[model samples]
Target: MTSTDRPLQALLAAHPADLPVPAVREALLQCVQPLTEREQVPLAQALGRVLAEDVVSPVDVPPHDNAAMDGYAFAGASLRPGEALRLRVVPHTVLAGGPAAARLGAGECVRIMTGAVMPEGADTVVPHERVQIEGSTLHLPADTVAPGSHRRCRGEDLRAGHSALPTGLTIGPAALGLLASLGLDRVPVVRRMRVACLSTGNELLEPGAPARPGAIYDSNRHTLRALLTRLGAEVIDLGVVPDEPAAIEAAFRRAAREADAILTSGGVGAGDADHTRQLMQRLGQVAFCHLAMRPGRPFAAGVLPAGDTAAARAPTCLFGLPGNPVAAMVSFLMIVRPALQRLMGATPQVPLPVPAHCTAALKKRPGRTEYLRALVQRQADGRLTATPAEHQGSGVLRSMLEANALIVLAHDQGPVAAGDSVDVLLFDGLL
Candidate 1:
C-alpha cells in the first residue's frame, strides 16, 4: 500500500499495544505530509511562515572588497616585516557608499572609512590609532599591522547565485533582514496551517463565569491555543464541549471542516466517558489511543472526515490528548506540535535535551518514561541545575507556570538522586 493509504493502520501494525516515545515520534514524522499550498507575501508579513523555495542571492553581499573599519587602505606587498613602513597619503578620502577611489600608486595609501570600497591595488587596512601621521605621510610601527588584515573581500558574506535561505525554513527576524538585503519585497511561503482546538468534559466551565459545584475552569483550550499560535499555526478555538455524543460529534465535524488539524482534550483517557472515542471510531481511523509515558500516557491520533461529500476538503488530522490540564499541554508539545509543523510545510526540529544536575531526589518506575516539571537555573559557574516543582500531578495546572523546563527520565531509567545529571527540555524555544 502507498504510504498515505491507511497510514494510521500501517503505523499501528508496526508498533506494540502501548506506543513508546520514540515510536510515537517516528509515526508522526512518517505519516504526516507537508501541505502544498503557497502564497506570495511581503517580507514584512513573512515572519514565522515557511519558505516555499530557495532564495538565491542576486548579487554578492558587500558587492566589493571593502575596508572593514575606519582606516587607511594600502597595498600589503609594500610592508616589510621588521621595519616601519611609510607611504604618502592620497589627498582624497573615500567614504562608504560614495564613488570608489583611484588605483593606488607604489608607496601611496588612501584614507578610507568603514564599509568603503578598497582602492584598486590595495588589499589591507590599518586602523587610524595603529599608525602615526606625519604631514601627508602614514607611518606603521614594526610588526604592529599584518598584511591583508581588516579588509572584507568581495562575496565574502554570500556569493551571487548562492542560496541565502533554503526551502522549508521558517522565516525569522534575521531571515527577513537577509531577504531585505537582497532587495526582495516579497517572498513565496507556505500558507499557515489551520488548527482547531476544543476541551471536553461536562464539569468544565469557562473563566469569568460564576463558580459552580464540582465544576472547574477550562484551561486546556486556552493553553492549546497559545501553544498553536506560538508554533505559527492559525488557531480555531472550538471552545468547550460536553460529554454528550451529539455535541462532541458536531464539534469534531466542524473542526474537520474548518481546520487542517483538530485537537480535542478529554474523552480519550481510560476513565473518561466514551462518547468522543466512539464518535472518533465511527467518523475516522484511530491510530493509537494510549502510550507508555508519564503525565501523558493517554493519547490518540488519526484523521477525520472534513465533510459528507465525496469531493469535500481533505481529511483533517486528529490529535486526541488527555483531559488533564498538564497532561494535555505536555502531549501537545511532545507529539502534536511536531506533526503540525510538518503539515505546515516546515521541517520539524527535535528539542535538544540540555543536561543539568538535579537538585532533588525523584522516584520512578522502569517501564514508563516520565517528564518532571522543573525550574532550571544556571549557576554562577554556568552549570544548569533542575529543581522539581512542588506538585507534579497531571491535574496541577499551576505547576506548569511554576516551571520553565521538564526533566526527562528515560523508560529504562530508575530513581534519580540529588546532584544526578539528567536531560532537560527547556521551554524557552518550545513554548
Candidate 2:
C-alpha cells in the first residue's frame, strides 16, 4: 500500500511524525481545529484582531462631487483660442464645506478653490494658475477645455454598501482608518482566544532567582507568552509547575477551567520523572504522541473536556511540549501557534520558508527532520549564507536567540556540504 493507505501505527513505527516537520504539520491540521467567534468590539480595540464578518460601508466617500483644483468654475464650451473672457467672479468665496448656491451662466465664471463644491451648471475648473483673478472679476484663458476637467466625482474612493473588508481579514491601521471614515465607532471582530501557559520541571527556576546546581532559569514562559501575545491571544500565565503528578494535574485542571487552550513545556519525554504525558492521559484524551522529529520528539497533544461540575463547563485544548528550551519553542511555533489561531477564528496558519545556502558542512541523522539554528547573513556577493550556530542541543536557548532562522533538514537527508541550498524557517517573517 502507498503511504496514504498505511495505518498510523505502522507509519509511526516506520517513519515518525517527530522526524518529519511536514508530517507533524499535516497531523495537527487533521485534528478538526476550529476558532471560536463572538461579539462586536470597539474599533479602537480592533487593531491586530481578525474580523468575524465582512464590513460594509453605509455611505459613499466624499458624499458629493467637488472641485479638484483652485480655479474658475465655468462652462468649457464658451472659450476660444487666444480669446480672453472677462467675467464677474461671485462675491461669495466657496471654501470647503461652505454653501454651494453659486451658479455660472453663459459667458460667466465663478472663482472656486480646491475641494470646493462644484457650482451648478459648471462642468470644468480651470486652475487658478491659468486664470487671472482681480477682486470680484475673473479672467479665463482663450483655450477651449475638456468638460469635467478637475472635477472630483462623489464616491470615487468607495460606493455606498460596498464591502470595505472581508471576513477573516486581520485589521491593520489602514483598515481602522477606513472604518472610521465610514463612521463606524465599533466593529465585529473574532473574540481573542484565551490561552494558559505553564512551564514544568523542578529543575526550572524563575528568572532572577538563585540558580541551584543542575537547574536553569525558565525562559520558555517568556518566549511562549511573547509568541501568544503576537498572535493576538489573551494569555494567562500559570507560572512554573513542578514535575510532580499532583502539581501537574492541578495546573491542567485549573487551565482547563479558565482558558480555551493550555500550553505547558517540559515533562512529555520518556524520562522517569516525565509526568506531563501521564497527566495528559489521566486528564483528557491523548490524541497523538511521539512525533518523529528531532529536538521535539516528546510532543503531546490532547483535548481536556469540561468537567461535569458547573465550574468546569468549558473544555480546553492542551499541548504538552518538550522540556528543552529550543525544542519547546520550536514545537510551540510549529504546532501550538497554528492551533491557537484556528481557535481565534483566523485562517489556517502557514510558515514561509526563505531559500539560503549553507556556509559549512551540516550533519543530520536519518529518519528525523532537524531544525538547526543558523545565523543568516548577506555576503558581499549578495547571497544569503546560513551559518550553523555553535551549540545545536535542544536545551540551548542561547543558540536560538543568537540565530535568526531554522535551517530545515529533511528526514533521511544525511550530510550537506557547503554552498548547498536549503529552506530556512524565519521566525519574524511568519507574521
Candidate 3:
C-alpha cells in the first residue's frame, strides 16, 4: 500500500470514545513522520529551529585556566595556620587577556582581573573583598582561603572535541550563545514546517467585518495561525471556509498539496453542519477521537494525500482543532503541538508538568482528564500554588489569557481540595 494508504491502526484506536487522553495522544504521535529537509543557517538565524545533527566543541571553553574573580592570585601551600599570613603583591596587575609577567612566589601574590590566566604555582584566588591591599601587600583574612578556590579550570564548561549539543535540540538564545562561544558561524538546522491553517463555519465572520445575528467573528483562524507561526512554522492561512462539504474538501485538498500539515478549527464534532470531518474522511483517513479531557473533548487527526505530482512530499498531517478558543488552544498545546514538533524533526520530549498545590477546591470527574486554566503563584515560602481562573468554560477565551499554566488533572483523578498537590503544564514553555 502507498504511504497515504497506511492503515489507521497506527493513528486510530478501534473506538475513540473509550480512549483516555494519554492513549489518544500516544496514538496521534505514532502517525508522525519527521521531515528530512535540512539547511545550514547562521547561529543568529537558528533561534527556535531544531538542530539537524550533533554539534561538537572544537576547543575548550575559556581555552585556559583563569581567575574567576578580580582579586589576588597566589599559592595556597604557603598559607600557614594562625599566623595571619600576608603576601607581597606583584608590581603589575594581570588582565584577562594574558598571564602574569613572573611566576607567583610561595609568599608572593599577583593582583589578577577576572578571566585572567592563572600564573605558575598559583592555584587559589582571594576575592578583592576578602583581602585588604596595603601598599603592594595582600593581607588575607584568617581561616578564609583554601586551595583550588575561586579558580575556573580549563574545559570546565565544555571540553574540546566533545558533543556540545545533541541532534534535534531546538536552538534558543542560550544555545546560540554557546555556539558563538564555539565559533560556529553557521550550523545545519531542520527547515521550518509549513502548516495550512483555517477556521470552518457558516456563522463565522472575519474580524473587521460586520457581525449580524447568528454570526460571530472568526477568532480561531487568527489565533491558530499566530500559534503556528510562533512555533517556527511557515503558516499558510486558508481563511474561513463555509460549512459546505465541497468547499471544505477543496480547502483540505489545496492545503494538502501546499503545506506539511493542515490545522482546522471547527466541524470535527458530531453535528449536521460539521462537514470538515466528513470531507476529511472522504479525502483521507481521519480519526475522530472523543478524549476524556476538559476544555477539549472532541479532537481529530489524520493524513491528507498531496497527490502524486509532488512525489517527494509525503501526506500532510491534519489536525482538526475544536471551535472554542480555549479548547482549541488547549488541544493544540497538548496534542497538535507535539505532533508538529515531531514532523519538524524535533526531538521527542514529554512536556514537563510542574508540581503545585491547589489554592481552592476543584470539581472534576473520575473518568475524564481536565485541562483547567490556572494562575500559577509562587508563594513567599517558595512553594508553588495554582488557582483556577474564573469562568472555566471552553468558550471563555479570556480565561486562557489570565492563565500561566494548565492544571492537568489525570483521568483517574477525582476532586482536588485546597492544599492538594497538582501537576500543571506551563504555558510559557516551548511550543
lDDT of 2 by residue, 187-261 (tens): 898778888999887888999998799998888889889888988889999998988889988888888887778
Off by over 4 Å in 2: 1-19, 30-37, 66-153, 292-295, 310-314, 356-370, 374-390, 408-422, 429-431
Clash counts for all predictions: 0, 10, 0
lDDT at position 226, candidate 1: 89
Estimate, for each residue in 97-138, the C-alpha lDDT of model 1 and write its tens digit: 998899999999999999999999899999998999999999
Q: Model 1, residue 187: what's the lDDT?
A: 97
As a whole number from 0 to 100, the lDDT of residue 309 in candidate 2 is 58
- Provide TM-scores for the models: 0.95, 0.78, 0.92
Off by over 4 Å in 3: 1-16, 379-383
Question: lDDT of candidate 3 vs native?
Answer: 0.83
TM for candidate 2 is 0.78
Question: Once superposed on the true structure, which residue ranges of model 1 sit more than 4 Å away at CA?
Answer: 1-11, 14-16, 308-312
Which clashing pairs does model 1 show? none
Per-candidate local distance difference test: 0.87, 0.77, 0.83
